[model samples]
Target: MLQTIHDLYDELERHRVMLSFQGPLSTDLITALLGAVERKMEGLEPDQRTRRRVFNVVMECLQNLFHHNANLTIHEGTTRTTDLPHGVVMIAQADQGYQVLTGNFMAGADVERLKGHLDRINALPPDQLREFYRETLADGTYSNKGGGGLGMIDIARKSGGKLEYGFVPYDKDKAFFSLNVNVTN
Candidate 1:
């Protein structure tokens, strides 16, 4: 376990990681995360615009994780246990920019639906993406969780790149979803 800790530290340093967290999320935790990240970016990202852009992307990602997170119920041969909606978030420096990455456990069945949503957002150009954002806002259609489906769109606009995402199967009916976005400084 101690060796694993050292290895993890080495890996984080190699990747230039500024901040990382893993576990269930809450409103209070999110607020704290924003504060911590804001302070870190203020020191490392001298450009105000770049800092704001990255900060906004991180906010959107955390909100999505908290609001749209999928709950899980584990079954161990008749022993049932429901677990909190867990997630992972990391911010790292890249050659061209800063990378914001998030991952969460989700139902495998929802993967196609989310994949379609992301692909559609990736397909639109910037001008059209802005238009679509306005359109979504005007339509005022919101999920049961009360978001207007704007998080991913906003992330794309702020990051100014295609959303990189994938799913890793966790079990017969569950999977882990990962999202990666980059903001240039």
Candidate 2:
């Protein structure tokens, strides 16, 4: 356990991580993290545009985790337990730019749906991506979770890059979804 913890710490340090969080992803927590990140970015980077881009991407990432994290309920006879919305996020800086990474547990069945969405977004060129973003926005459609389905598009637009994502099986019916977005400074 000690070695594993040390290895994780060393990896973050090597990546120049500035902030990280893992726990129940709530609106209040997101707001507080935004503030903290704002201050940190202000001190680290002088370019306001770059800071804005990084902040926007981070916000979208956290919001996705908040709205999409799976709630696992285990029941056996009269015993039951409800799991919280748990996720992890890390913000790191490198010579080229800032990277915002987030991970959360999700139903394994949803992997293909998410993969398809991400693949479509990533395959579009910048111009087409912008058009798609606008078209989706004007459609006025939203998921039951109150998301307009434009978050990923906006994140790609703001970050000026493709969204890198993957899924790792966490259990027979669950997987860990991870996403990474980069903002150039």
Candidate 3:
């Protein structure tokens, strides 16, 4: 365990990671993380517009992590909020700009649907993507999490890039879904 953590730290440092978090994805944590990232970027990030874009993408990703994360096992007699919805988020600075990576456990049944959704989004041109965003918004449809693809559409719009994603099977009923969004200044 110690060696794994050490390796992880080394990899992150090599890539100039600015922020990282794993475990519960809660509203409180999201608020704190946004604050922390803002402060950290003050020194490293020079462009205010770029920082805003990064913040918006991070916010959307964190919301997805919070809303769609599958429930984790809680110890008997423990409160639900005590465990939180397990997820991971990391931000790293690269040559172009910043990369936001987020992951959360999701039901296995969702993998295909999400893959199709992402593929469709990726296939869209910028103008059409914006149109789709508006159309979806006007449709008044909601997923189980009360999102009408707004978070994802916003992420793509803000990032100015395709949403890259993959799913690793966690068990018979669950999979770990990972998403990557890049924001270039």
Candidate 4:
């Protein structure tokens, strides 16, 4: 236990961000997270644009988590799954800017679809990205999963850079999806 805690501390120190939560996620928890981050940022002198970007990105990430996290429920006779997916969200101050990362477990097919969408969005030039976003919203193909697929595109465009992403196989049947966005000051 001591060694595990020590390792976690070392990892947090290296990343300049601390790992804090595990277990059920809820709206109140998300609000507390935003509050904690705001308090942390109070000591720093980040510019207005950087601060606003950070705030927007953080909210989007949290909302995505709330909507998509793996669901769990216990009933009288059986167990059931819900739409919400399990995930982690982290925000950190890096040398160039703030970095927001969210990770969750997903099925292989969903992971592939997400990757393709991310690749397509990342490939677009700013003008094309705007057009694509408008088209997506106008076309009404947003998945039952609740995102218009425009969120990732908008994040990429607004960040003025490519989105950083990674996928790691977590088990025989599950893979971890991570999305990273950087907002420069």
Candidate 5:
């Protein structure tokens, strides 16, 4: 058991990870993480703009996880279920600046809609993306779960890079979704 945790530590160190957490997330936990990450960035990140962009992207990602993640159930020989919004969040060093990566389980039903919307967002230039963000905000319609793609659009704008995402099938009813956002210096 110690060896396994040591291996995990080595991997994180190799990746230059500054912060990481994986478990069920709550509003209070998210609030605490935001404050802690902001302080961590202040100490390590010298440039004010880069720090703000990284912090903003992290906030948006955490909000999305909080609002959208589905509970995960694993069936190996016995059934194991994790209730609440179980997810992972990591902030790591990148060649240009920093990378904020988040992962969570989501309903299989949402995959297509989210994929298409993200594809469209990636296709647009900065000006078009900003306009699209405005349109989404002005539409004044929020999904039953909350958010009208505004958080994602805002993430893209603040990161100044295309959002990278992938889905791995977990079951017929759900999938593990991961998103990677880069905030360059």
Candidate 6:
């Protein structure tokens, strides 16, 4: 099933460059995804700054998936069952830069809070964002159910761009939060 999804994504990548993977969304899978990205990037001539920014953006995006995914299922010996939370992440090459996209389900309140946070982060200048991130990390007072209130700000600062976000209403109580980060190479 995972291979089928990967193959479909690969077919779509012919027109637009992309590196995509889907699996159980476990910790092992996250490690493998990071390794795969590193390997793919090795052949390219990405400069040091671009490489570091891309790595940070990808890391934060995957961490978001680890925290927010709604459906977590484990299959053992032909029996499939739900486990923890899991979601899908895709990183693709864009005309101007690399785009990291992630999607996971979120409650309405969480969505609103995330939107507000992103807006505030977008409004901050680079120096203010850096200071805010440092202060938040040092203070350690703000933490969500998943922890790490600094991930979004870190992503924004590293990407050096405003986060492109969307909340698609999936039901009365839940919505899908999609985030995009673009890192120019």
Models 1 onward score TM values of 0.89, 0.87, 0.88, 0.79, 0.89, 0.82
Poorly placed runs, candidate 2 (over 4 Å): 1-11, 72-82
lDDT of 1 at 67: 68
Q: Model 3: which residue pairs collide? A: none
Q: Write the per-residue lDDT of candidate 6 for residues 20-135, one digit (tens) a residue.
A: 65534666778888888777666653587777788888887887787666554346644243554556677777777788888877666578788888999999999999998998
Summed backbone clashes in each candidate are 0, 0, 0, 8, 0, 0
Question: Worst 10-residue stretch by lDDT in candidate 4?
Answer: 65-74
lDDT of 1: 0.88
Q: Please, what are the lDDT tens digits per residue for candidate 2 over residues 103-174?
A: 999999999988998999999999999999999989988887666779899998888888899999989989
Per lDDT, the best of the predicted structures is 5
Per-residue lDDT for 142-174 in model 5, tens only?
Answer: 887577779889999998999999999999999
Q: Residues 64-146, candidate 1, lDDT per residue (tens digit)?
A: 88766566444565422245557899999999889999999787898998999899999999999999899988897888767
RMSD values for the candidates in order, in angstroms, are 3.7, 3.5, 2.8, 3.4, 4.3, 4.5
- Please report the candidate that would top TM-score against the real structure: 5
Clashing pairs in 6: none
lDDT of 3: 0.89
- Model 1 CA RMSD to the hidden true structure, in angstroms: 3.7
lDDT of 3 by residue, 48-148 (tens): 99999999999889889887866745588684864578888999997999999999999899899889889988999999999989999999988877877
Error of 1 at 32 (Å): 1.0
Tell me which residue pairs clash in candidate 5: none
- lDDT value for model 6: 0.77
Best first by lDDT, ranked: 5, 3, 1, 2, 6, 4
Give model 4's clash tally. Answer: 8
C-alpha positional error of residue 65 in candidate 2 after TM-score superposition, expressed in Å: 0.4
Higher-TM-score candidate of 1 and 5: 5
* TM-score of candidate 4 versus the correct structure, residues matched by position: 0.79
